[model samples]
Target: MFDLNCNLRRGISRHYAIDKITDNHPIVKSSKKRIDKEYSKFAGILIDVFYDYLLVKNWEIYSDTIFADFTTEIYQSFQKYSGDIPPAARQIIGCMVDGDWLISYQHLDGVENALDRIDYRIRAKMGARIKLVDAMLILQRESIDLERDFHAFFPELQQHILNFSLG
Candidate 1:
C-alpha cells in the first residue's frame, strides 16, 4: 500500500522517500528553486560533520559498494537543503545487495521543514556557501549501510514504520 501523504512512492520499501516528484504544490515548487540554490551550503555542512565521524569511525577505506552508495547519498542530499523538497523524498542512493534500487522516499513534512529551517540558519550564519561534498558522500554511504544492517537485523521494526503518520 502506498502512503501518498508520507514520502514513500507507491510499491517501494518502507525506507523509501518519494519527494515531490511530479508534484505541483505552489509552495513546494517555489521552495525547490531556493533549495537548489543553497545545496552547496547545506551539503558542505553535512560533509564536514560526516567526515569527522568517518575519521573517528575509521570508514575512510570502505568497500566499493559502500563507497558508491555513499557517493550517491551525497549527491541526493542536495534535495535535503532544498526547502521545497520534502525530507521523506525518495532518493536513489545505491544498489541493494541484489541489484535493485536502494532508495529512500518517505517524507515527514515537519522534519523536512525543520531541516530547511536549519539550512536557512546555517546559510545566514556563514554568509556564504559551503562545499563539503566529500564528507556528505561518506556520511550518506555509511547511513545507507546502517539502515540496511538495521533492517536486516530487525525486520520486525517495519510494522512500526507502517503505522507511523506522515503529517
Candidate 2:
C-alpha cells in the first residue's frame, strides 16, 4: 500500500515536475526504505487517512445509496484488515467505524484535528518535532489538485486493498 501511494505520487509528479524524487533509482530505493520504516512505525495509519479522504470526498462516485451505509460497509472492510494497524490507529478506526469521525477531512477543522492527533502520537513515540501546521498548510494549498489526483487514483486503490484483504 505504501508503495502504491509512492507510485501514485510519482505518477502525479510527472505532470507537475515538482517532486525531487526519481523513480527506480538507488535514491528512490533508499527513500522507499525510509518511507516503509515510517509507515511500519505508524502501523498503517496512512491507509486510513487516505481512504477516509477518498470515502468522504468521492462518496457520490462510489455510491448511489445512503452515504452512511456505504461508508459503513467500506469501513468494515478496513476493519478486517486492521490487525496490522497500531493500537493508536486501532482506537481511531473503532471511532471511525462507528461513525464518530465520519468524513472529518471534509472540513479544515477536521483536518487540523486529525493532524494534531497524528502529530501527538508520532511525537509521543519518537519525540520528533513534526510541525503539523506546516503539513496542513501544504494540504490546504494543493487540495484542489490533490483531490483531482485522488479521484483518479482512489478507486483502483480501494479495489487493491479489498482484493488483498480477500486473498
Candidate 3:
C-alpha cells in the first residue's frame, strides 16, 4: 500500500509537470494565440484538445503501433490499474473507454463533441456561458498553423519527458 501510494503520487506529480511544460512552451503559446479572441480565455483548453486531434491525425509519423491498438492497450491498462486509480479519474476512465474518446479524437465531429462537453461542464460548474462548440470553426481555420506548431512542439515535449524520467 505504501509503494502504491508513492507511485500514484509520483504519477500525479509527473502529469502536472508535463502540463506546466506544455502550457509554458513557446510553440504551444503561439498555437494558443492563433485562436480567435472569442476563446482567448479558454485557448489553453482548446489547444490541448486540438493537439490531441492533430496527434491522432498524424499518429503514423510518431508511432509504429496502430492507433486503435494503442488506445485499446491504454484502456486495458486503466482496467488493470483500476484499483489504484483515484475515484475521479476512474469515473473519467470509464466514460472515456465507453465512449472510445481517444479514438474519437481523429474526427472533426468528435472534437466538436469534446468541446461541447467541456462547455457544458463549465456552464454547470461555474455558470460561465461559453460556446466551445463554435471552436470547431476556429480549429478548421487555424489547423494548418496549429499542426505546424504541434509538429515543432511535440518532439521537444517528448525529450522533456525523457529527461524528466532520467532525472
lDDT value, candidate 3, whole model: 0.90
- In what order do the candidates fall by TM-score, top score first? 3, 2, 1
Please say which candidate is ahead in TM-score: 1 or 2.
Answer: 2
TM-score computed on alpha carbons, candidate 3:
0.91
Q: Please write out the lDDT profile of model 2 over residues 1-167, one tens digit for every residue.
A: 35644544544545333122222234323323332333444323433354356557678887687776766765875565566557987887787666556657666676667767778877888897654534555455545655654565556555654554455
lDDT comparison, 1 vs 3, better candidate: 3
lDDT of each: 0.37, 0.54, 0.90
Model 1 off-target regions past 4 Å?
1-121, 125-132, 140-147, 153-157, 164-167
Model number with the top lDDT:
3
Worst 10 residues of 3 by lDDT: 1-10
* All candidates in order of lDDT, best leading: 3, 2, 1
Error (Å) of candidate 3 at residue 43 is 0.2
Q: Whole-model lDDT, candidate 2? A: 0.54
Q: How much is the lDDT of residue 77 in candidate 1? A: 50
Residue 115 of model 3 has an lDDT of: 94
